[model samples]
Target chain A: MRLLLTSATSEFGRTVADLLSGDHEMVLTDQTRHAEGHPDVVACDLGDDDSTDRLVAGIDAIVHIGHGGHFSSASDLLDVNTRCTYNLLTAVRNAGINRVVNLSTLRLLDDYPEHLTVTENWRPTPGVEPVILSAHLNEYVCREFGREGGIKIANLRLGFPLVAGNTAAAAASGESAALAGDDLLTAINAALTADLGVNAQSTDAPHPVSFRTVHVQSPFENGRFLLKGAASILGLWEGQGVA
Target chain B: MKILILGGNGMLGPWVVDALGDRHQLRITDIGEPPETTHEWRQIDVSSLDDVVDAAEGMDAIINLSVLRPHRKIAFDVNTRGNYNMMVAAVTHNIQRVINTGPHYQLAGPSYEDWDFDLNPDMPPQPGTRLYAHTKALGQEIDRVFTTKHDVYLQTLLFYHLYDPGDIGNGPGGSGVESLGKDMMTPYSIAWPDAGEAIRCAVELPLERLPSRAETYMVFADVPHSKFNNSKARGQLGWQPRYHLESLWNKR
Candidate 1:
């Protein structure tokens, strides 16, 4: 599938770009012109609907990095996540793009006690920090579009402090939760392709909206965060992660 | 109580001021200078974090009536970021209460209003298409997050149509229209003073009296239109509307 990877210059964006590059056709876009730019990257501020529309044309899917996605002010962070996501999804609907994978963080649920197993259905307690708050705002905008039945979004609230390799994973091992490179890729790839109707054969299935929030994390040995929501809604198996 | 009112110069600002002014001290802030009033006013932009934090200093609570309806950029700036800033300030200052206001459509946009009746505000906000509704909904969601995390009591008063007592109900040949999608959306109706009273109720209600840290109340009067309900406001906040908006729905 031809994918449009937004905020293409961020570390998270670059990681996803590197991971997904082998299989899919990637069209990278940054909100602003980057000094160190990628060959596949096209700079476009998503707040401008016309430019965003032009950028999204001919794309099969989008990997929207919901957080650490913008290279702008904290105020613009709110716009890029909420209004720009709204603008981009509006464009996606206009362009008839059916599927989108929005990268979010499991830290939004960090407020929950460690002993209690957390799932996607639980209300995210993404308290007042701007980046987390902004990403939370992104889910709100994307879900509304899904409720409108215009676009289908797979919102992945992945684990905290996304690590690069085995060594870095080892370095950050003691942390509450962490997502390694391969697990992140597997979740995104699954989200991009999984049928939202995998279980719901009947027309009146209880799918509230075209959107599904799945918790994705590289749950290493006896990890507390559950991947059941991802497995059921997105078909991403627990075994497939980097455990 | 010494309350800081952000975007306190908008349409609902004066009404809120009128309702709470005599009872509590107010430090109101808006992007532009407020209308000639004796209330303490400051030229503050809610979108600016510094501006909001500065104005929130030494305040017991905050009332965010700041809203921008047009221009996508400014709309998001004031409606969404403004709320984020307010929540951050509320947490920073340890202010215990916030009275947030927005249109009813922010929760029940065209999708809810067009499809369902007896609509209540508690329904998970489905603010589908309208820009104003969408932005304000995002703001309200931010407030919910803050209330969940902190000790702040978030009383969001959702309004739709603001009517005056003396003004004539102008509908199709003076017949009541349940809702007006005619020029723009006025999905529910409440007198400005009644809306103010609802804010006052929220402002003064004992924190223990609130069911939760975060509660949303639809603030319109009991009009004949069966579109939206304010049972939550009445039952929860003990809000009572003085004007029933009889001309708009009842036979004159």
Candidate 2:
């Protein structure tokens, strides 16, 4: 499947683009042409309207993972994080491209600890402070867009999802190995390339691809499946040689 | 299936073990030796994840009811990290469900100093506090992460302050049961049976359907002045707390 990756110049995004470019037809987009590494590059700023229009034009699905980590102010972060995501979804709707795998951080509910158990029904505590509220606003946006769009949207709330190093090994630093930089790529690959029989491990990345939606489906393993074996059903690993 | 109560010697732990023991295999553990009961007993410290993992092995589910009081680091280590380690072990072993007794502070967000006891999980946690509340908030977050990311069916029930009338000597002020020193109990209210019922719901409900984050249930008997809201427990989990101030206030 042909794909468009936002923030293709990012360290992780670039890595994903490189990994998928060999197997899938790919187009790269970013606010600026930071790196000319990809054959198909589009200079479009997500902050602009025209960029949204152009990005929605021809892509089959999107790996929407572009944004600055820090913000100048609380409002700026809210606008960039929440509005940028909304714009992407709206653009996708207009472009008629439905599948979106939104890359999110563990910070959506970051104030909590690693052991705390929250189910889908447990609503996050209402936000009071500006920063906390902003973080929540980001999550609220995703939940709303995903619910209304009727698109296949998978929001991965990564738990210390690692890029390359061992987050757990820094044991004292509380950092260790995490979902690889290519983990999202693997998720996209599963969403696009795999067939029904795809097992856990594929040529694309480590860990078997099992994509589950947290919205409607009961978190229970035995409950109704929103999209069972979505990773394999989408043929996310079909082109990869990781058999 | 064997059920283990990690903080079995504490206020709610023993009661929960008693309430559920008739039908389930009950095992009790704590920093101290488990009290004598029909259920099997073990001495364990859940703060050490390995020990918890070992104790949790082969158990159907593990309920954590232990906590360190007043000590910030201790509370954090036990409530947050300790909870994580226990859940990690539980998830790795594929324990069916893990029930935790989350602190009431998660609901303390919207509450004021005078209103601290009236917390509801739905309210944002009260901010800028020192001691137990902060540690508990961290613990609740950890609960959210593990239940969501690791696929552990975690149920966290936030309990109100517990009061045992039968044992007033145990009260903080060293007051005797018959000759109550002062009538301050009106302000600090908790119905033990109601608390047990809420706890029962937590253990029985399909945890995965519930959010993995901290969830709270008020333990007070229905009182005109009761500040906690436990309707969610009643509506969703089929829990009905039997004791109320009207029922227990003048009886004893």
Best candidate (score: lDDT): 1
Candidate 2, residues B98-214: lDDT per residue as tens digits? Answer: 777755554453234354444455665552233455445555555555554555676667765566644444323434445243334443355565566676777777755575434
| Deviation (Å) of A77 in candidate 1 | 2.8
List, residue by residue over A81-199, the lDDT tens digit for candidate 1: 98888888888999999999999888788888987877776888887777888888898898888778867888888887777764247236765567778778878888888766432
Task: Give the lowest summed-lDDT range of ten residues in model 2 chain A.
Answer: A216-225
DockQ top scorer = 1
Tens-place lDDT digits, model 2, residues A1-243: 788777676675666677788778888776554435544567665643666787778788787662323334533443444446656766776777767765554444444453444433345553333344444444544554543434556654443434442212222233321334344445556655332232345657643322323321111222221222332354332322111
lDDT of 1 by residue, B1-252 (tens): 999988788888899899999999999888986777787889988889899988999999999999999888788889988998998898889999988999888988877777888898789888885789999999899889888778888989988778765564542233444433332333477788888899999999988887789888888877665778888888888888887666655444
Alpha-carbon error at B163 in model 1, in Å?
1.1
The native-contact fraction of candidate 1 is 0.84
Candidate 1: list runs displaced more than 4 Å. A33-40, A70-73, A161-177, A198-209, A219-221, A238-243, B169-187
lDDT of 1 at B235: 89
